[model samples]
Target: MRLWLAIIVGKICAFASRFFKRGGGSSLPGSLARRIEPHILIRLLEKATPALTSVIITGSNGKTTTARMVAEVLKHSGLRIVWNRSGANMVNGIISALIEKCSIRGRLCADVAVLEVDEANLRHVVADIKPGVILVTNCFRDQLDRYGEVDTTLALIRMALKDAPPGSTLLLNADDPLVASLASGSRCKTMFYGIESLDLTSGYTQDRNTVTDMNANMNMGMNTNMDASDMNASNINASEYLPHDARSCPNCGAYYEYSLITYGHLGKYRCPRCLSSRPAPDFPALNVVAQGAHGFTFAVGFEHDSEYDSIGASLGLPGLYNVYNCLAAIACCLLLGIPKMIIEEGIAKSSSAFGRMETIQIGDRSVLLALVKNPVGFNEVIRTIASEGSNKTLIVCLNDNFADGRDVSWVWDVDMERLSRNPSFIRSIVASGTRAEDIALRLKYAGINQEKICIEPDLDRALELGLRKLAPGETLYVLPTYTAMLEIREHVRRRSHVREFWRA
Candidate 1:
């Protein structure tokens, strides 16, 4: 009876939230519902449709985009999908999504629940719901003050996987050593996905520093199809490319040997002492082609299973990080027995999540919004910005709000120094947010001229200044932390008539 009341109250609150323009009420209603019924999530899951298949996606990065991709593909394939579209990924947010989908009598109307779970909260969600598929994108050093070390994040996720149902499948990233390491202890079935070869220097305009960093880490002599011989460590020092946390193998306390380092310690790696290595990926992305601000096209290889050898896929979202997200989504759909044709079409049709490489038009200028909370994600946004050719206006908003991680020190870990490599690509920089001065300082230290940097603590003023400075035909890239994204995106929506994030 308490659970039933919780559902009724939650639905009413959700309706009021939307009607009053209280910003989606993505967590508040569920939080209130949970207070009334402590085990509301568990009880609600018990009443869920028997045919409903829940998919929980969690990691340091790519959770929103990956979950959005999976949900869009499944929905395109005609399966009803209930997801937290507003980027609310916590336990309360998930409960809110479920409550929104549940009818007045407490019946779930969906066939699949594609949820993006926070790394620390994974254990709680899994305890209540045995997901049909658990997809982990990658684990990196993020929210250190909040989540401690990357190892703790991995351990928390590992603990959750231990509780996963027997029949569930774990789709993991083969490139990330920490993520791939989870398969070793899990009782549930596991599937891995990764990239076989990446050559980003050609066919697109990109951050020369980013491309150089990747190429310097890889053997330039390798052809489009890489082999064991190409894995020789003659290209560059792998340590320089790896994040401070991922330099060593997770299995043993030994330094990892890598044949390739694809941005921040993710790539082909093996441990000599423990004899542990990156497991062969069941679904491998081959011949990845970056389309600048447009996204990527690659071939999905199904070597072990399926009828077709490989299927061509494309995503409208840009960056190499998104390629991994796409692969994880494709792998999850395939595991659920979705047809290859449906998967291909769904991928092509899938769009970016809110504030995740979302583009808005302001008169003749194109403005791109990307949320940056951590080092790896921030660096990828920088790469995307640099990749969009030259003469671009950049606005970087850094907030230390509770949602954005109180510790602003993580900005130092980002590869801001690379921005100095091609000083001409960025026409001007507007530093805005609670920590605007901090970002301005970082850019100055990165060798950007003081003349090009403007510190505007107010987001609205900073956005106006950026647009005023933006030349016709050039793109303005706005990168902000989580809370900052919400604030600035609301402003953009009102001015440009873009759909509200919840509606999108």
Candidate 2:
């Protein structure tokens, strides 16, 4: 009776929220419903969705995009997907998504529930909702104040996986040692997906000393005027590297040697001390080619196997990060018996999730909004920007909100030197958010001239300043933290005829 009442109240609240246009209303109703019934999520899932195939995606980075990709593919395959499309990925948010999709009598209409669970909240959610498939996209150092280090984040996920449903298929990133290591303890059926070849030509040096030097530069901050030669940026792709983020073998304390590098700590790596190496991926994205900010194309699967033959796939979303997301989605869909053609169509059709490289056109000007919360992810965004080759107008938004992570120090670890490789290419930069001045200082240190950089803490004013500085028809790239992304996106939506992120 309490559960039914909670469902009724939740449905009413959801209707009111949508009618009033009160944000996305993705989590508030679930919070209220949960309050009415403490075990609302578990009770509702069991009573409502008995045969539902639940896909739980949890990782430090790429969870939202990966989950979105999976949901899109499943939708293309004719399954009704209920996902937290608004990026409200918490305990309450997951419940709210379910409640929003469920009928007044608490009957969920969806065939599959693709959920991107926050790293910390995984344990809380999985303790109740037994997922059919669990995908861990890649583990990177994120939200230092909240998640501490990558190991802490890994430990949290590991604990949650332990509580996951028995016999659940674990779709892991074979390239990410941290993610691959999760399969060691678990008895669940595990399958891996990764890039077989990234086709990186320039600055491709995959050696131990190169990693050591990069880590040294990261530990001891690089000089403000540090040129390309000082950090060996040209020889080894220092900008793509993430210091000591994923060097050490998860099994042993020894450093890893990479045979090939695929941006950050993801690549073919082996530990000399323990002989722990990258697991052979089942769904390998071979011959990967980057198409810059426009996106990339890769052939998935190997040519040898007839049943699992290679098929070409392309993603419209920018960054190799999205490629990883694509691979995870493809792997999950394939495992669920979806046809390769359907997967390709879904991959090609998948749109950016809110601020994950979402491009908005305001009259003649094109605005690209991307969310950057950590060093590795920020470096990839920087890489995508540098790849454009054309002159750039950038608005970097840095917030210290709790959701955006309180410690704004992670900005220091970003490869600003790489972004400033061709300083003349960057026409202007507006540092905006709560820590606008901090990012302005960061850019200044990274060799950006003070004349070209402006500090506007208010997002509205920042957007105005950035758009004003932007030339007509040129792309205005706005890199924002989580909260900053939401704020700036809302501001953009009002100015233009853009749909709400959840609907988009």
Candidate 3:
């Protein structure tokens, strides 16, 4: 009786969500369903498990991209997968996706389910749906207002891992200090993946160092600009930006010196204090070559699994960040015994997440959507544009909504100075959204010509002005915060005759 009741309620929630235009579904209904029918939904779904393996991908930046790659690789291995391709990582969204694919009788029919879960909600949803494999991409400081700090978020993720079933495989990035530290404590079988070599010129580097006095002044405004010296004094020191070279023993006071640095503090580090360092990975992608905006090429060792036979594969996403995501996916797929050829083919054909390097055709003009929510992400976007070798106009939308950090002060931390330093490549700059002026000010301080900067808080008008300023065959790059991206996509859909397939 209770099983039937929960199903009825889930269906009703699904119906209501559609009627009210509220995004709903996933284990959210399971929460309410559990109150009325404990264990019923889990037992029911567990009984109808699909033949395709289940994989859950989580992290701060690359969850969507990694999940898409894993799904593509599995598809190449002849398995059908049902995934939330629209970048919906919440509980209700996952449930809605499952409900959409499941029969009215409540049975999942796909061969596999590849889910991209939000880091914060991983604990809540993982308990309800025990995934067979968990892939953690990487952890970074994001949305300070919501996540508090990187350490706090990492602790929460650690607590969630405690509940993972013993047999489940944990795939982690060995390069990330925070991620590596967490994986060390897990008892479950773990597989680590990371960049084997450090490209110093392409990686992030700290210009200065600082020390923090934990007790000196906790009352400083969140937006206050502190130099590296002050940042270190405040205990907010920037770790080495190279991921591969970061090697410190968190357990002891000893430092693990890295032979190379990847990004941030992720790299080969050994604790001089404790004699502890990451063990060499069992499976690593070799011969990585950046293929510009089309992704990268690399070879996976097939000895671990015969399913992958191809020597090289290329991904369709843009930026070095996508390369990190692809590496994570390749590591896991190789462990799963996927064929090399299939992995390569899937990667070559895969597209990026919505509003994440997604391109659209507006009449004769091409618009590229790049989501920039934080300084780190924004810096990468700017770097990508710098490497493109073409002069272009930029439409940057800034919003201070709850999801985009109520404090837009982080903009000051960004190295917009680089953009200002280069005037030849960027012809015009258009800023829009509630915090448009704030972004404009940052650009001006970075040395951007104030004459070339245009601010229009109204998104539609900003789009018109920005588009009008573009020359034939020229591209307009759109970089927007979370809410701003949604608004920009809506405006594009309403005005332009072109189809907006990359909707959030």
Candidate 4:
């Protein structure tokens, strides 16, 4: 009775949301259903999945992209896919998605459901749904207002794993020591995936020497700016590469020593005190045969056959972070028994997600959407844009909306100095969204000249001004947080006459 009642009420709300032209139809209905029936989500999962395989992906970054990649690959594999493609990922959203796919009598037709869950919501969602596969994309300091500390976030995820139903395979990011540590205590099977060799020159570099800061002001911005020192790690004040807030050994609390430095605190590192280290990846991205703005090509650690082993799979996205997401998806599909050729085909043909490195073309004007939610993610995106070596316009949107975590201090951690250092890389910058002025102030502090920066808090006008400022052959890069991306992406979609995000 509860399931049926919740479904009917939720379905009515979802229909009303669409008819009212509300952007995301999943949330209102889902939230209502959950409030109406506390166990509605769990019952929906059981109803949908006795005949279907369910995959849950959660992490600070890359959940949407990674989930999207897996969903597309599964579709190509000929499974009737039913997923929350619009990124509505709470337990409530999961129920609503299942409610849509299941019949009024509660029969399901889908073969798989790829659910992208939010970091904080993982514990609740996993408690209700025992997914066949749970993929943890590398965890980083994200939305401090909501997550508090990354370790706290990790602890929550760890509990989720501990409580996860038995026989579930935990797919993890082997390159991330923090993520790898989840395996130390969890009683679950684990599969790992990571980049074998990162092309740092593409947009970032690793610190080659040892740097220690026992009094490090640890936070999400642990690796904010470590590129200005001529002296190596021998000097206490020397510039250090920052990333992965837990620079000290997780086991012994001693400083981690580096073997190879990649962006942030990722790459090869071993604890000198406890001898803890990064785990070996099962599906390693090997041999970077090709790399650049368009994408990259690499070989997998293992293959279905000898002929398939040497095949160069390409991740059709920019930056090492995106490559990491692609690796996660590849590892996931392989575990799910997807054909290598089909996975490769999907990867090669994969387009950008709604905001992450999305490009919008309006006749001759092109706007690139590189969504930036946290300091770490934002830094990577900035590095990618600066490395392009092209003079472009920048539209940066910073929102303190509920969905955007309500804290805007992360703008300070972004190395806006990258653009300031280049001087010529960003022809002009327009700051938009609720926290536009704060971001503009951040740019100024980074040494960007005030004359080159424009403050337009209104998103619509900011979009117009940004496009008007775009010169021929030059691009406009729209870098926004989650809420900012939603608003900007919607405006661009309407103006471009393209379909809405969920419709696709």
Per-residue accuracy of model 4 over 166-274 as CA lDDT, tens digit each: 7778999877778888887777788887667655444333232322332232322233335543223243322233345767778888876665544556667777778
Which stretches of candidate 2 lie above 4 Å from their native place? 201-241, 302-306
Q: What TM-score, over all chains together, does every model reach?
A: 0.91, 0.92, 0.83, 0.91
Candidate 1 lDDT trough over 10 residues, lowest sum? 221-230
Candidate whose lDDT is highest: 1
Please, what are the lDDT tens digits per residue for candidate 2 over residues 257-366? 77765667787888878998999998899888766447678888943336558778887876777888888888888877778899889888988776787888999988
Ten contiguous residues with the weakest lDDT in model 3:
214-223
Model 4 regions more than 4 Å off: 199-241, 303-311
376-405: candidate 3 lDDT, tens digit per residue: 678678767766555678898999998788
Q: How far is candidate 4 from the true structure (C-alpha RMSD, Å)?
A: 3.9
Distance from true position, residue 398, model 3, in Å? 1.5
How do the candidates rank by TM-score, highest first? 2, 1, 4, 3
lDDT of 1 at 158: 94
In terms of lDDT, model 4 sits at 0.76
Q: What are the lDDT scores of the predictions, listed in order?
A: 0.82, 0.81, 0.68, 0.76
